[model samples]
Target: MAVIIKPFSLTVEDYLKQEEKAIDKSEWIQGKIIKMAGASANHNRLTLNLSRLLPLERGEQNYEIFVSDMRLWIEESQSYVYPDVMVIQGEPEFTDSQQMAVTNPCFIAEILSPSTAGFDKSQKFTLYRSIPQLQEYLLIDQKSYRVELYRKVGERQWLFTEFIGKDAIVELEIVNIQIAFSELYKRVKF
Candidate 1:
């Protein structure tokens, strides 16, 4: 006979309290707590490259960029996620008084991984769309020079753009920034 254990669920409050002291990060979706896996070398490199390339201040507009450590709260789905990179045009809105999780992000970028690529493109993207302040979403392929951009064109419409090859450039319309594939993939092995 095989032995099996049933999965347990945690409330939003319980999950937040536990996550505060946990060594590793985990995501809260509905009532389930999903542990986040460690990022790969290529993923880290891509994240760093993009973060450094984003200007802190473009003209009179000030922007705040956060790496992987910051948490993003999706109110519609009642979930929390840690994106690879998040860009806020102005001040960020926190979920609570603790200021641990942010609610508003104008631009978000995620480096695709073998394990989470599908989710990132589908379910995760759905949750991100619920954010009223989000304007652009970027998905970067760590294994190759490929990038996808989804820009909000209307209240319920989004424009999709894809860039391929090493010489291609990614244009972030919301922030008015452009980055070349070579620069974004710098120091990345694949």
Candidate 2:
């Protein structure tokens, strides 16, 4: 005889209720809530650097910047994710009538950690592409100054670019700002 066990499931409403009180962040997918690991020192530094480097120019045709704490809803997957950094142009669309989760992000940047790099590059990136208004995606290395940018050019086409070394600079086209790798890696010990 073989023994088997079933995974636990939760409705989106229940997941949100739990998430509101949870100390740490969790990703809700399908029907299960996956708890994310605490960010490393390097990861934390990079995330902060990335956010700080983003230009705060807001008036007309500007973007709203959000840190990782904000929850993002992927309508296609019915999953909620927290990107390291997010940029929303104009107004952001919320998930529920209560306006709990964001459904639109013009640009998203994810700081790569050893544990989540593979998932961020594959599943998470694919999930983010489902957003019709997403124009750019960035994968930034936490331990080093490597960055990969994907810019959406056509309806279904995307252009890829990579920048490396401390002297490199990534041009945030959506916001018309450039971020230097040196600045982005500041205070990052690794």
Against the reference, the lDDT scores of all candidates come to 0.88, 0.84
Give me the runs in candidate 1 sitting further than 4 Å from their true place.
Answer: 1-6
- Model 2, span 1-190: residue lDDT tens: 0111136778998988898899977888767677777778888888888888876665558667898888999998999988889988887788767766798998999988877888888878999998998999999987677999999999888999999998999998888888887788988887
Question: Weakest 10 consecutive residues, lDDT, candidate 1?
Answer: 1-10
Q: Give the per-residue Cα lDDT of candidate 1 at 68.
A: 86
**Cα RMSD to the true fold for all candidates:** 4.0, 4.7
71-149 in candidate 1: lDDT tens per residue? 9989999998889999998888888888888988999999999888888899789999999999999999999999999
Provide the lDDT at 131 for model 2: 93
TM-scores of all predicted structures: 0.94, 0.90
Count clashing residue pairs per candidate. 0, 0
- Give the 10-residue window scoring lowest on summed lDDT in candidate 2: 1-10
Segments in model 2 whose C-alpha atoms lie over 4 Å from true places: 1-6, 97-99
- Prediction 1 global C-alpha lDDT: 0.88
